[model samples]
Target: MKIIEKMNIEKLNVIYQIFNEKDLLRKLSHQGIIKLHNFFQDENYVYLVTELANRGDLGFLIKNVSPLAINKSMIQFIIAELLMPLEYLHSIGVSHRDLKPENVFVTEEGHLKL
Candidate 1:
């Protein structure tokens, strides 16, 4: 779960914008760009329930893994897997402004998930 606190006006505005973009978020989930399960709002905070990526984000793995162990075939596979979701998003007129290793999640089955 992700929590957003409403302590300042700027934060509030950003939260409002996120809430306003629910349609796009849902579409992203359908396209495998994100795993948004559900969202809720209340007087104090906004809660987001999403996929549990037990293997954590790509950045953490990259930082810890040995460079020599990442062979050519593995690199190709990761790129190819990531590209499908990106292409789908582009075809639907959506762009992920924050595409980075930290945003990509890995699954326990050794698969990459957006």
Candidate 2:
């Protein structure tokens, strides 16, 4: 769940960005992308309910795992998984501006989610 405080949104002047993100998430329907289940705004905050990536994110996995354990094939697989969604998004005329390890989540079955 993402809780965006109304005050912070106003302070940061990111109301448009937030709305853009919400729209993008709503339009996206790929296995590698995070699923937005619901969205609502109250008096104090905006709530975004999304799918859970129980295995956490790519950054967490990279930091916790040994470098030697990450083989070339594993790297390729991760990259391929990441690229699939990018390709899909591109085909649909969308570009993800923020692409990073922290933004890539790992699913319980060891699949990657953008």
Candidate 3:
């Protein structure tokens, strides 16, 4: 497909995966990071609307790990920040079941909140 067509298909696929409103909410809520905006179905299709984070996931950052010198505190901060999602999910009775360096994400504020 052309680039534009491929992009549209991706968006549609995201919408189709939800199955329904309830499923979408449960799934997105469990994403541990991104904020879902809305999910709906109209006649022949389902749609999922969510806040788009251009920075991408933790997997990307980990793959691009920097070689520059860093302090121990920085490492500790990264670990804690990434673990917060796992902690919050578990507290809510949800287990990520797939916790790993790839499943984390760092937001733009340098807060490592995700």
Candidate 4:
């Protein structure tokens, strides 16, 4: 779950980005994108409940594993999997600005999620 402190909402741009992300997540329903299960705001913070990516982000994987351990086929598969969601987002007139290894997650079953 993502917890955004209400204190940060006083910053107009931060609030805008937060709500914008929520809106984008709400509209997206592709397999490659992270799933947003629920959202709610309390007096102190706003909560976004999402699916758990048990394997963690790609950045973590890359940082800990040996470079030789990641084969060509795996790299190709990850790229292909990433492209599907990018295509889907583009088709819906949405552009993801901050896409990096840290933002890409791996599911328990080894599937990718953006």
- The per-prediction CA RMSD against the true structure, in angstroms, equals 2.6, 1.5, 6.4, 1.8
Pick the winner on TM-score between candidates 3 and 4: 4
Cα error, candidate 4, residue 102 (Å): 0.9
All candidates' TM-scores? 0.78, 0.89, 0.53, 0.87
Ranking by TM-score: 2, 4, 1, 3
Give the alpha carbon lDDT tens digit for every residue of 1-114 in model 3: 001233554667743433443353445453345565665555554455555545556667656768463558778987777677667766767555556655454556654423
At residue 109, give the lDDT of candidate 1. Answer: 75
Over 6-39, each residue of candidate 4 has an lDDT whose tens digit, in order, gives: 8877765588788889988988999999999899
Q: Where does model 2 exceed 4 Å of error?
A: none
Top-lDDT structure, candidate number:
2
With candidate 1 superimposed using the best TM-score fit, by how many Å does residue 70's alpha carbon deviate from the native? Answer: 2.0
TM-score of 1: 0.78
Error of 4 at 31 (Å): 0.8
- lDDT for each residue of candidate 1 in 9-107, tens digit (9 for 90 to 100): 355567556675555766575434557789887887777777777888888998889999788998998898789888887888878777899888887
User: lDDT per model, in order?
Assistant: 0.75, 0.92, 0.53, 0.90
What TM-score quantifies how close candidate 4 is to the native fold? 0.87
Predicted structure 3, TM vs. truth: 0.53
Clashes of each: 0, 0, 1, 0
Give the true-structure RMSD of model 3. Answer: 6.4
The stretch of ten residues in a row with the least summed lDDT in candidate 1 is 25-34
Per-residue error at 53 for model 4, in Å? 0.9
Candidate 2, pairs of clashing residues: none
